[model samples]
Target: MKCWWEHLMHLPDDLSEMGVVLSRVNNSYTAASGEPVNTVQTVSSISNREVNSTDSEHSSVIPIQSKVCEPEEVLIPALPEVACMERGYVTPQQVYNLLNAEEGQPALYDPYYILVLDCRSADRYKDSHVVTARASVTVIHPALGCLISCIELQKYCIILLYAEYGCSPVGSVKARADAPDLQRCFFQLSDLGMDPVILLGGFSAFHALYPFLCTPRMVLVEPERHMLTIYPSEILEGALYQGSATQASDYRIIKNLHITHVVNATANCPNAFPNTLCYLRLRLTDDGQQDLVEALPLASRFINAALKADPAGRVLVHCSMGRSRSSALTLAFLMQHRQWSLLHALRWLKERRACTAPNLNFLRQLITYEEQLFGSRLTSLDDIRR
Candidate 1:
């Protein structure tokens, strides 16, 4: 006996060819042409109907059973293990600092090393892009060759991908359609074993935040408004001091605090005490996006060496503002020297310096460093919030 679905499949393409008028009644289909055509009820509806209600004339009808087709399993190729730092997100301020870093300077993390790709349209990219950004329609196949060539040349290349607003703008019907393609490009680059970071809030947000840095024609704003005053605070009893550039420059305060060493955590922040004090200048940026992982070990060594040099020696760590960068290094020092957990060290520092807190990315790197030292993570997202 033929199945009901098989019979329906054999129907004429033009239903009118057989002079048949197909109509549905309740859960069953009926064909009205000559006499009342008895059709097999659907598998679902068959159980619901009374079996005895079927006439002897329709006894030959066969009910078809529905079978579900299972989806085929697919194997995805694993990406090669590239020895690279975790590429997360960068901000406009960090991008600006990277572009403005002085030439021939020794930087812990070089922004020039990373390849910034603007994923906007060609016209939009032509109008303006981040100072060092390259325009790309797609970063998959065609761009892969160039990227691979750069890798072969041993050019430590990290890819930074950004779209218009990090996502399709609201009410942008066309952009919404193409949003998935942009995301696919990012993932494809990652799958190709390249370190890729997506800029947070994208080009629009960056342009709004740093318009002067974005285009050449934009005028520079006043510096005083952006300038932050320094106030050195004690991290350890007398061994560690965390402060800003201003605080580090104040010779009177340095003398009063009995400081012997200074750790400058800014890219081009000059050494205030040239011959008077021992100095270790780390070409670091205060921006949250700057890579603190690479600088952690070096900064820790400097702090430890300073403390080990003399029992009474005092080290002062400072950046443009002593809040983020200096605090991060101080935390790293405590974690490395005292073998304290990241959270415990942060809590200890916070007790002395109320404003001691690293940027989100720097804190994440500290967490990573903590895990590297210990066997597991000692801090979590909730701990950071506290």
Candidate 2:
């Protein structure tokens, strides 16, 4: 008798297409009569030739053999139910709502709830954590096992995990250390059938975005107290004051800087300055998906009009973060007025404001806008020569 390996080597490549089912029983493998086999097993083939008496047709059948081994005790790990397998990223605001929802709330009753797990060191968590987050040591299995048991009792639970600012944030581009403890905990809980999501930007980003909601912990060190006021940075003398939403709200900052016009670039975020200043609201989202191109022409016209309207005319362009959307608009206005390429405009802005990185998509749109205005791409021979 030929070995199983030898038989497998001679089997047809199109055996699957032949509508034959291969199965393994005990120590031997056999091919089913008509249907295809779907059993998991190693396959071997044997050729048997037979001639039909009535039709005088030659038919070939291949028999398969499987290797057998001694039976051994096998244990399978239990997986969580399908309902508890939800995992993804959740925004800071979503996490906040989950923690703040009142008892007997409409959607947040019994089956639907949220649990925030702070996976940082005990000391760091003691320093600060989200108001409702539970600081737990996640490096060990017992700690995670206890959390999993509690999660199993809940009908529908959303488990949010967070650490320091180094973990992936909503709008951050920086990289950080590999968080093995957090990863291990997430996997273990997920395997046991629990819905989990990483809080994007972690506690640091969350704290920065929603400082009012954070707990009052001991000040580790007397870090420089940077006031939250938005002081407008002068881009063009008497022409522009680029800053954040806080600055836009600061009438004193606006008045002291002699800002005659205001361009609000945030969507749904109201303009803080009064009607005394000329207002142009773009209503753009600060994320990468915002259509900065759609508002470019209008924003440029407003900024240019402000500058040309008076020698002392100054316009303040601002967004919620004063980073992505506001910076893109400011760049657009500079490119339009100064006839500078996008690269040159960005360099100039960065020199004035170190934190002016427009999101990737917005930067791409600025390149397209540059091409539209200058009749060439953002980078040209003139730029390279300079």
Candidate 3:
């Protein structure tokens, strides 16, 4: 008899050959591992024979003896850890399962809490953010220096961004200035009974990841003439619009993009001239009955016009911050295009943009409004907007 193990080692990508001991037994023997291990094909005629590697003449006979049972099939992919490191995720199948599952499961085999933080700017979020996410603070502006803060704070869940990847990505880009710090942040936070999943693409990705959980930022405004403005030019003064600066967060971003309309959702502002700015604002409330019926559709129209009129011309729809109102309007645009139902629309949107929180009240009102308009007609954010 010849040694089967020696010949098995030469096969390509064979895990069984990589030392998964295949011990043969009586015909009635069941595998203790219960993993559906198949028996050797020629088990009936096989006789136990241990061949020593020191014996050089047995090489030729070994090949014939080992050709009995073919190698077990490779069912799933053996993903490389390094490949996962570059993509910032385990697998597309895993991400899809996560997105599709209605309820989230805890970390495998361990009771852990996931912490997600909104780290846009230190000045903006100074001493702010979800309390559960304090593992470390890594700022996403002016060279991304918060690596130490994250390590010290032990932040587990970190969502870093400032005006859409406009900031951060600094600190010798060759060494993964932002992501490396996130990895360290999670590792440190893991020490404190927490598990972190940093938003890979920023808060936008988180918003996309969980849209139904979003709350809308309210903008209470008084109707002026026929449109709405988040903050009047006089009120904005030095706070809202800024001069030409590629990196600054101001009206210049809209102007440089040659946007036609600047739809402001902030309430209580008097109107004024365009003044190199984009378009006018459309309020979302009148006598408090969710003014979005008038505002949302108009916003949809303006965005459509902006995109079609120039395609490159951008439309900046904003409230006090870019979190709520702007996000809602953008979502509306997306719903209109995709014809998705309100729930599905919200779900899909969050899976793509996660920095938003659709206020529960706002969501209810939008759903109600959509239902009332369609009246037994299947409606979604996408259906109404388009």
How close is every model to the real structure, measured as TM-score? 0.40, 0.40, 0.36
Residue-by-residue lDDT tens digits, candidate 1, 91-141? 554454443322232121343355667777777877887645666553343
Candidate 2 lDDT, tens digit per residue, 140-205?
A: 254436543544525445667787754443223342344554665566666766656787667888
Better of 1 and 2 by lDDT: 1
Residue 124 CA error for candidate 3 (Å)? 28
Query: What are the Cα lDDT values of the candidates?
Result: 0.58, 0.57, 0.36
**Of models 1 and 3, which has the larger lDDT?**
1
Question: 1-386 in candidate 3: lDDT tens per residue?
Answer: 11222221222233322333333343221223433343221111122221112213221222223232111331221211122343223222223222222122212111122323444444433433322223235322225544444454343232322111212333335425544544444444455544444444543443353332223321112222112111111101111221111112345334333444455655543222244544545444322344454445445555555456423344555554434555566555544533444555555444433334556456655576445433433444454335
Top candidate when judged by lDDT against the true structure:
1
| Position 343, candidate 2: lDDT | 77
Segments of candidate 1 deviating more than 4 angstroms: 1-231
